[model samples]
Target: MSSSAHSDVAPIVVSDVVKRFDKVTALDHVSLSVLRGETFGLIGPNGSGKTTLIRMLLGLGRPTSGNISVLGRKMPSRQVASRIGYMTQSSALYNELSIRENLAFFGTLYGLRGRRLKERIAATLSLVELAARADSPIQTLSGGMRQRVSLGCALIHEPELIFLDEPTVGIDPELRLAFWEYFAQLNQRGVTLVVSTHHLDEAARCNRLGLLRFGRLLAADSPDALRARSGQQDFEQAFLYFAQQAETAEAGEPTPAAEKEA
Candidate 1:
């Protein structure tokens, strides 16, 4: 199949994307892709350059080198960006705005208005199961509720691709599960997703995951394939094993665990 055929099914394409921060090269030639309707995950510990890569993809940070295309269009462009929704690690909401108002504002930015806008708001609130609290001021909502609202705001325009960066951090476990369940439901209906998370169990739900370390793409594979290759029983072990390998390769030394066992 021609290379273009792949992008038709995969809404996200990262081709040798590199990002640097003055003295630190945050992302070292990172490359990956997320297929349409699939839950693609970026997993790694804190400071693994996961957030940096995410910012680059979302147009919050320009890539120092390389390219990222979303929805078959090059990123940081108005044409391609309209069809994408984004939720950052931090709450990106106006505290004084009501939940419904927040969605409407973001929806308007995506060119949604009138009856169409109203329908989208209700749909998002319902999907996040926050319909009853739609009128609540954003500042009054609990952390988890605020996250749901944040998520709802992202969905107001019905974007083809969604970027969620550490969206579940500080969220209660029960609500976290619910939020993921909502993501799975969206995927079932053909919405593409790229989620960055620290929860290994949650990361396993993704069709494929990219493990990052020090602004580098360490391993990118199906959860099962990664586990099998690393002789691990869970995704966490698979990730740690690969991270250690990457570090060893860079440092030209044995993995600490390997040295200890020896």
Candidate 2:
């Protein structure tokens, strides 16, 4: 491997990234990095700009200011686009097509063809436990099943990096576990994942996490590190603690917890 590849270069880097929507700022000078081969969770409540940031990272939208680099190249660059896979919150599959056909369509879009595409289709279907439903029309599947199909489509190209926006939404506990297991397996094989979610329990499974709120990043660190620094018992409490600290700093006041500690 080249020195750059072996070094501690992060797979995704956002430096002071900002996005605006006319009167409203969707992302406010946010910054974070997703390390190689690790699962990095973006945890926050709804309308926290998690999806907006993901869209910018994927080159779907341009940041009004700041820079973003994915896989060592500047983002929105076609050179590195093929090296990434994105699974959005909404199902993007063709509802009239069979599950297998959806995978084939996406695989082809990623430049896979002929024998390789056929093999990848079979592998991804089995990975998501949808081999039995390969021939079933997408509209026939339940919401969770359709989500799995969407995920399978993202995996069909075997990209080095994966971005999942609320991937486990509407999924049962059992299937959620299965999804995490598959994610772990992919990480072991050198794929990096950036998963955005509101589920604290799921956030705890990540190697590192970025807590976001109101278009800003409150904290970014390992779950245990965050809990320890905030003196909280869980991820949710730690997140709230950090958010409060941010608010206090912005308002030029010492946080209540900081005052108590002093």
Candidate 3:
């Protein structure tokens, strides 16, 4: 084996990963690499295994087969998990805690303390543009602000890699742009980002994208490359084209019920 293959330079890597729930295969021999400081996106229809894949990558859920590595460390290994910051699609914050308190708590849990904890809390809130609202009740913040606060909480320990699952769901277009801007800024600062979202228009912002369906990886490449492969000028059309191709290939296949949103 090549020495670099086992080396830990990049943030996330997976090889032939598979996850199953009884007879249902949530991920089927999936493979991908998230390089250090790059923005990688996972795109797929609902129930196409995006969330399950992220769970496997985060080691929150185990893969039934194959391998996954995060931050140069093999996962499902609890010892290496602290290097990854994960934000689920849902707000995982304590609803009763103020934004500042929430960040403080998570920071402390991540082994931060004293000036370090306070410094991270202050810097992250500012990074997410939520410094002024640090004292606001988590329940009182608007959907967009709440999402930003959730993002800040994730960054409290400044993990070198971040996995964001639909982090922009409730955020408006303007703030969505701002969120990507933050991702760009973070990436520039050497933070690797792995994100999955249903937003096709926003998918263009990613440096690379992987398209999955029925727990299988159909395509993985840049937006431009995927568009070229689909022979479509527009990305939305390109996604639909791939979806149609997948359906046409399956025996008695039904067109994806969620394609309407794509």
- Quantify all predictions' global Cα lDDT against the true fold: 0.82, 0.87, 0.82
Local accuracy of candidate 1 as per-residue lDDT tens digits, 72-181: 65767666677789898888899999999999999999999899999999899889888999888998988889999989888889877799999899999899889889
| Cα lDDT of model 3 by residue, 1-262, tens digit | 1235333565677788779899998987777777778899998878999999888888887789898877666877776666679888998888888999999999888999999898998899889888888898899988888889889877889877899999988778999999999999999988888899988888899998888888877778888988888999887788888878767666455533222111
lDDT of 3: 0.82
Please give the lDDT score at residue 260 for candidate 2: 13
Return the TM-score for each candidate structure. Answer: 0.91, 0.93, 0.90
Query: Native-vs-model 1 lDDT?
Result: 0.82
Query: Residue 170 deviation, candidate 2, in Å?
Result: 0.9
Clash-forming residue pairs, model 3: none
Instruction: List, residue by residue over 126-217, the lDDT tens digit for candidate 2.
Output: 99999998999999999989999989988999988999999999899998998999999999998999999999999889999888888888
Regions more than 4 Å wrong, model 1: 1-9, 251-262
Query: Residue 255's C-alpha lDDT in candidate 3?
Result: 34
Winner of 2 and 3 under TM-score: 2
| Candidate 1, residue 32: lDDT | 82
Residue 190 of candidate 3: its Cα lDDT? Answer: 83
